[model samples]
Every structure is written in structure tokens, then in C-alpha cells.
Target: IIIGEKRLRQQSKDPRTPPSHQPEADITPSPSPRPRPPDNLEEGEVEEVCEISTPPSEVLVVEGQADEPFSTDHAQRLIGQIMVWNGQIDRMRDQIDSMRKRLDTMQQEIKNMIDVLGRI
Candidate 1:
């Protein structure tokens, strides 16, 4: 992305200025240089290099469109929802534990009553 930004900035230069005169940092090296024709070759044999850089104006438009929602209000709302869900989960776990304890106590009481009746 940074390289693309640099290329876009380079392409925004004035048309009158030659690339050779541009600042060194603004230039990016190509993967491979095009092979030059022999000196004796005719002018028609030489290939024209096509510039493929994106315009800086278009880059600005794209960057503007990619801006995301990162406001504090949005973050706070998400955090609040998470906290509410967490609290509800904790309450549910406590209720389950309380019910288990009550069940265990009832079973013990029933066993005690059965033993007492058998002895009688």
C-alpha cells in the first residue's frame, strides 16, 4: 500500500519535468529493465515505454472511501453490550449452582426420612 501511494505521488508530478530530473526517493525500480535495441537499429524499431502509474487524485478518492467508523461512541456501545452479556452469563451460572445445592439438600432429607421409617 505504501509503495502504491509513492507511485501515485510520483505520477502527480508536472508533465513538463523529465523523470530523470525527479527526486531520487520518489522513483521506484522496475522488476526488470526493458532491453534496448542495437544502436544501428532504425527509430521505428524502438519500443515506447508506457507509464502505468495511478493518478494521485484517484488515490485520494479511494482513501476517502475506505475510511472506517472508529468513533468512541461506537466502541463504547460495543463494550457495553459485551459487559451486559457477560453479567447475564454470570447470573445464569449462579442460578444453576443454587439449584444444584437445593436438589442435593432435598435428596439428603428424603434419605433421612426413609431411614427413620425403616427403623420404626
Candidate 2:
């Protein structure tokens, strides 16, 4: 009888308790077909490139205007620019790898010297 009354009291208290504290979801829905900023656009410039206009090298959200008023020369220029940038990135990566190997060798040498000193 006592346990039953306690449970009933608990249930009554639960109803009076306020809902769990949680952040309210923003009432506004996120913008659809939102204009994305250009990746290569210079600072202070407001160039909005549609997802469709994104280059093949980029992870495109949506394919931008390809047919309407498209320039073949501009496309070719972008391709050439990507090629040069990719080449530079590859060279820098190689240089970084080489430096890492040199650093590892130097570290091993230091460890060996420390071990020899400990023995002495």
C-alpha cells in the first residue's frame, strides 16, 4: 500500500515537473538553392559561383551553369591552372616526405648516442 502511494505521488510530481532543458530548434528553415561563394575568388570581392560552375578538381555541391554563355577559353585556362597547382602540390609533398625521412634518421642517431652515454 505504501509503495503504491509513493509511486502515485512520484507520477503526480512528474506531471508538474517542467520539460527537460534543451535548445529550441531555430524556427526558420535553412535556405534552399542558396548561393555558394567562389573558392578562388579574391578577398573583398562578392563573386557568387553556382555549384555547377565548380571545376572538376573541386568537390562540387551542384553543377553550375555550363550551357548558358559559357566560355571555352576560360574553361581551358582553369584546366591549365589546376594542372600547375597540382604539380606544385606534388613537388611540395615530395619535399616534405624527404625532410621527414632525414628527421627520422637524425632522431635514430640521437637515440643511439643516448644509449651509448647511458652504458658509459
Candidate 3:
């Protein structure tokens, strides 16, 4: 029985036997190479090329103040708004907790009333 099984395995492994049917894989051609900058560009030349590429109006110049982008007044207003919203959220959470406690107490009372009526 082992010899017969070995013969069947050898027959299955034969290269002359046709392969199982399978869909052919799609073969796509490789994309073309991208253009690159020349290797011999100097530091100054590179900076000049970048400056030429960018428009002047898009560039920002901050002369006097380092933190001009975020003024103290704007920061204070944002902090005030955050504090007000935080207080409102705390109040809403407290109200929800109280409502849940009331609901639980009412449910317990109704259960007790039902038990008393059942006893009667």
C-alpha cells in the first residue's frame, strides 16, 4: 500500500502532466524615468533658483515682533472662550448625573409599589 501511494505521488509530481487552469496575470510596462536637477549645482545657485520659482507676495516678512502671528489679546480671548465652554460642559454633566440618579430612584420606588400591591 505504501509503494502504491509512492507511485501515485510520483505520477502527480511528473512535469509532463498539465498544470491546473489559472487566469494569466496582467503584465504592465514600467513607467519612464523622471527628470532630475544637474549634480553640479552650487549653494547660491540653488537658493537663486528657489527664489526665482516663488512669487514675492507669498513670502512673509516679520521685522519687529517675533510672536506677531499670535497676539496676546487673541490668546486671552481664546482662553476665555475655552473656560466658558468648559464650565458649560461641567454643568451639563452634573445635570445628566442628577437626572440619572432621579430615574434610578423612581424605578426602585415603582418596583417597591408593585411588590406591595402583589402582597395585597
Look at candidate 3 and give me any clashing residue pairs.
none
Whose lDDT is greatest here? 1
lDDT of each: 0.61, 0.55, 0.55
Q: Candidate 2 has which clashing residue pairs, if any?
A: 51-62, 52-63, 52-64, 53-64
> In model 1, which regions exceed 4 Å deviation?
1-71
Once fitted onto the true fold, the runs of candidate 2 whose alpha carbons sit more than 4 angstroms away are 1-68
Scored by lDDT, model 2 comes in at 0.55
Q: Rank the candidates by lDDT, best first.
A: 1, 2, 3
Cα lDDT for residue 75, candidate 2? 85
Instruction: Give the TM-score comparing model 3 with the true structure, all chains together.
Output: 0.41
Worst 10 contiguous positions by lDDT, candidate 2: 1-10
TM-score of each: 0.39, 0.43, 0.41
- List model 2 lDDT by residue over 7-109, tens digit each: 1111113445543323232233233555456688788876533232223332212234342333688889999999999999999999999999999999999
User: Model 1 RMSD to the real structure?
Assistant: 21.3
